[model samples]
Target: MGALDFISDYFSISTRRKKRKAMQTVDIKVKMDCDGCERRVKNAVSNLKGVKSVNVNRKQSRVTVSGYVDPNRVLNKVKSTGKRAEFWPYVPYNLVAYPYVAQAYDKRAPPGFVKNVVQALPSPNAPDEKLTTLFSDENPNACSIM
Candidate 1:
């Protein structure tokens, strides 16, 4: 009986399953006024397939969902609960001197913060500032690794 079953299984065609996209964390800003709102938000996201966990912070009005689920789908699920939801915009910690401040929550980099300003843009009529510097190439070690 075992020999016949083994032979049949071995001859069966193997089908390749579709590869899934990389897993990502979906952070949504949903305002939950009370316990009921928090419960509803949590339940909606938890019921979604492939959602590993749902964390709702009522004080901060933030709902963080981690799993292989799509971010848009997670946002939609939260929105289905009748609460306004938007993708959480993240600001890099190091860029801002005071990240916790309310003004530092801008979608783009904060004021007076310069990032990746390696090269100055070329202007047709402008004077060459490169020629004005006195010790331009005096030190070979002045080159930045970045």
Candidate 2:
């Protein structure tokens, strides 16, 4: 019986231990008006299991959490504190090719950041497009070879 039990445990898929959550950072945008708001938001997230650290920047209205926790769960935890919370939607301006595009620009975003949205114009200088345009009759600089 002991031998049979050992063999079953070795081959059974269900006997494997559950995998631990991976370390990750979750950034949330929460409007924190004052020190109290910051403390509340920080405490709410830090109390959750597996949270390693919490940072709140009231000026940017952002909370950064580092740990082995799900992002949605952290967002829900922030919302539970009666504050409107959402995932950070801004990316560095220099990272985007068309930073001034309608959907990507936001007046409310902090300096050097823009809303993360699909560019309105496809890249005009794409290699494939450049190759096509080089031989097309419409290009003024196209090779004169017929």
Candidate 3:
């Protein structure tokens, strides 16, 4: 039985199976206007140490990065390009959805030194008192109610 089995058997060197590392995709909101700005933003993030790929859509003004890096670290990289960055809710951590919508954040800053001028902007919750800077204990980064 052993001799017959040995005579019928053939030997060949080959890999049994390959293990692949899973990658995660994180979406970010950007305020990209032109093609140049989009490219610049994409390049900045794609060049990161852990970033695997970058896809920027100008119409939606969003940047999606694929990798296994930390989300906070990726967000910081996006902000370095002079664009506001936040977590995108549409895209999942797994690779399934091909295209996802990214929300863009654009803010306007007060112009000139007249900045020292006083204003009578009322508080959102207070509704009667004025506020220099609105502070919310719950969500500090949220927009103030108008």
Best by TM-score: 2
Tell me, by lDDT, which candidate is best.
Answer: 2
Task: Give lDDT tens digits, candidate 2, residues 12-128.
Answer: 967788789999999999998889989988999999999999988889998999999999999999999999999999999999987988899999998899999987666678997
> What's model 2's overall lDDT?
0.91
Q: Residue pairs in steric clash, candidate 3? A: none
* Full-model lDDT, candidate 3: 0.60
Pairs that collide in candidate 2 are none
- Report model 2's TM-score to 2 decimal places: 0.77
Superposed on all Cα atoms, model 1 deviates from the true structure by an RMSD in Å of 8.4
Decide which is better by TM-score, 1 or 3: 1
The root-mean-square deviation over C-alpha atoms between each candidate and the true structure, in angstroms, is 8.4, 6.4, 14.8
Off by over 4 Å in 2: 2-15, 122-146
lDDT of each: 0.72, 0.91, 0.60
Q: By TM-score, highest first, what's the ranking?
A: 2, 1, 3
Put the candidates in lDDT order, highest first.
2, 1, 3
Ten-residue stretch with the least lDDT total in model 2: 137-146
Worst 10 residues of 3 by lDDT: 109-118
TM-score of 3: 0.45
